[model samples]
Target: MTIWTAIFLLLGGVGGGLLSSIASMASLASYPVLLAVGIPPVYANVTNDAALIWTSIGSTISSTKELKGHWKETWFFTIFTVLGSIMGCILLLSFPSSVFEKAVPFFITFSGIMILVSGKHNTLNTEKQPTWLRIVYLGTLLIMGAYTGYFGAAGGVIVLVILTYITNEKFIVINAIKNVISGFANLVALIIFMFTSHIYWLQAIPLAIGMFIGGYIGPAILRRVPEKPVRIFIATLAFVQSAYFFYTAYLR
Candidate 1:
């Protein structure tokens, strides 16, 4: 409620947004800050998804240049993602957090490995993929979509890993594509949470603002940065996320 609290939340948003665009792991920055700022675990996660809508918007707006010809791919993936997100949201409300919390770290670890093996993903000819492979890709996206709706800590990273398998585009382009797809996952969660979950508007406002700013600049940063290091960076974050979640889920 204090001005300082608002300022702090804004700063958290900026950092979350930056990490989101650059690494697909905004929750690494935002989740803890929400907890630090005194939001309960229950509200923080939903609020994070709610504010993240701006991250999607900010990145998409800035991505106009990169997205010039990729609308078809972006929207196509969204269809599966939206359905999965709805399922995820329902599961979140219907199930225990421990269920996904225990599984997410593995998802993160798989994503890290996927990042390392990205070259192989790019070698596949998307156009020539068999119908079964195409189904697998969409199927994976649907499952990942549910993941995004469930906890969604690093949902973008999860999507980024699968995207490489199907799109074969440059990392920058993949980043842009994941932004819209994962953003919809969170956006869909927000829409559902608006009716069912508790969203702390006070923190959500500033967090949204910061993520928007960070998301806008992330794509441009990727455009200039080399892909090798960015891949390493994202993979590293994935491992760290996995380790942290494992500790929380099994150890602590």
Candidate 2:
């Protein structure tokens, strides 16, 4: 890649990482950049997964403070997430290029709406989480993890929502645990992708560096900004992207 292309990928990683810390959908920003830079769609997707693996390292460290004493709480969920991610990675590599090509826009649109509507509530207020609910959560995580392993734009957001429903934990703690475990899920999938896929190393290296920088910025910004406006802004952006995805996927 040229120096300019490298620079763009770097910035894309930074943006992707920062956005990831907040709500997940960050890949939406970087994937297009990869395509624009001449990476084929499948290669761009795989390379994005490769680069995004590191973005979680820093974010997970920061979230650990809030996750203290929460080991048992997270164990089962983590297992499901890891298993799901592995399944997803396998599915990803198995698919024809045309499959992912047709699926991408739909995935984006679905994930976007999920983040937007789910953002409205801060927590699940119901008394007991029914066994059925946990089943739904498990099934959802598995599918989402596979998708995340394949194309992780808003994986964190999905985790956050599921956790919110499962427990009465503080939002901060829930979010922190979400980061660490999701990191694990992505890490597992990323390693698998590294061996099996055509990772755009030239692109991934710079983007990973940018993600490291951006991860730091994201939490700091969230601390300073009030919650409502931030949610509004993020939700709005997600909605717009969702609309775009819908248009691109099924419409045209």
Candidate 3:
């Protein structure tokens, strides 16, 4: 790769990292950059996954303070996330991409609406959710895990929205968990991809470096922002992006 391409990817990674930390949409930044630099769509997606492992690492380290005391509660979901991720990887390798590609709009739209509605529910009501609600929540996470493992554009927003309903923790705290769990799910996929030839190490190296730096910087910015505004902003972005994806997938 040329030095200019490397520099462009590094900058993209940095932007992606910042957006990821704030809105969990790092792929929005890095994926397009990969395509612009001449990587094909499939390779770009896999290479993005490979490089994003570092975003998780960087975010996890930066969010250590927020993650404390939540590990016990998070462990159970983490297991399911790992399982879902593995399942997603199998599906990706074994099935036609169109199967999932067609579903992306619905997934994004549903997730965006959920986030918007969840904002209306009071987080302070500590009463245990009904059994059905619990089941639905777990199911959502499992599905989200699989999605993240397979094609994780805006996956973090979905995870963050579901987390808001299940836990009363501060948004930043929930976001921290979102980072770890999403990172974990992606990590499983990355490891699986590592054994394959799809990864472009040349592009991945600079992207990873950029994401690492961005991840670390993301939380610092998050701390300064008000929670409600950030949530609304992210949900709005998700909806807009969802529409764009739908247009490209169906109408275009």
**Best-performing candidate as measured by TM-score:** 1
lDDT of each: 0.87, 0.72, 0.85
Q: Estimate TM-scores for all models.
A: 0.97, 0.84, 0.94
**Given candidate 2, what's the lDDT at residue 175?**
62
| Pairs of residues at least 3 apart in sequence or in different chains that clash in candidate 1 | none
Cα lDDT for residue 15, candidate 2: 91
| Cα distance off (Å), candidate 3, residue 23 | 0.8
Backbone clash total for model 1 is 0
What ranges in model 2 sit over 4 Å off? 97-127, 150-153
Judging by lDDT, tell me the better candidate of 2 and 3: 3
Q: How accurate is candidate 3 locally (lDDT)?
A: 0.85
Q: What is the C-alpha RMSD, rounded to one decimal, of candidate 3?
A: 1.6
Model 1 TM-score, all chains together: 0.97
Better of 2 and 3 by TM-score: 3
How well does candidate 3 score on lDDT at residue 222?
88
Q: How does residue 186 of candidate 2 score in lDDT? A: 79
Candidate 1, residue 156: the lDDT equals 83
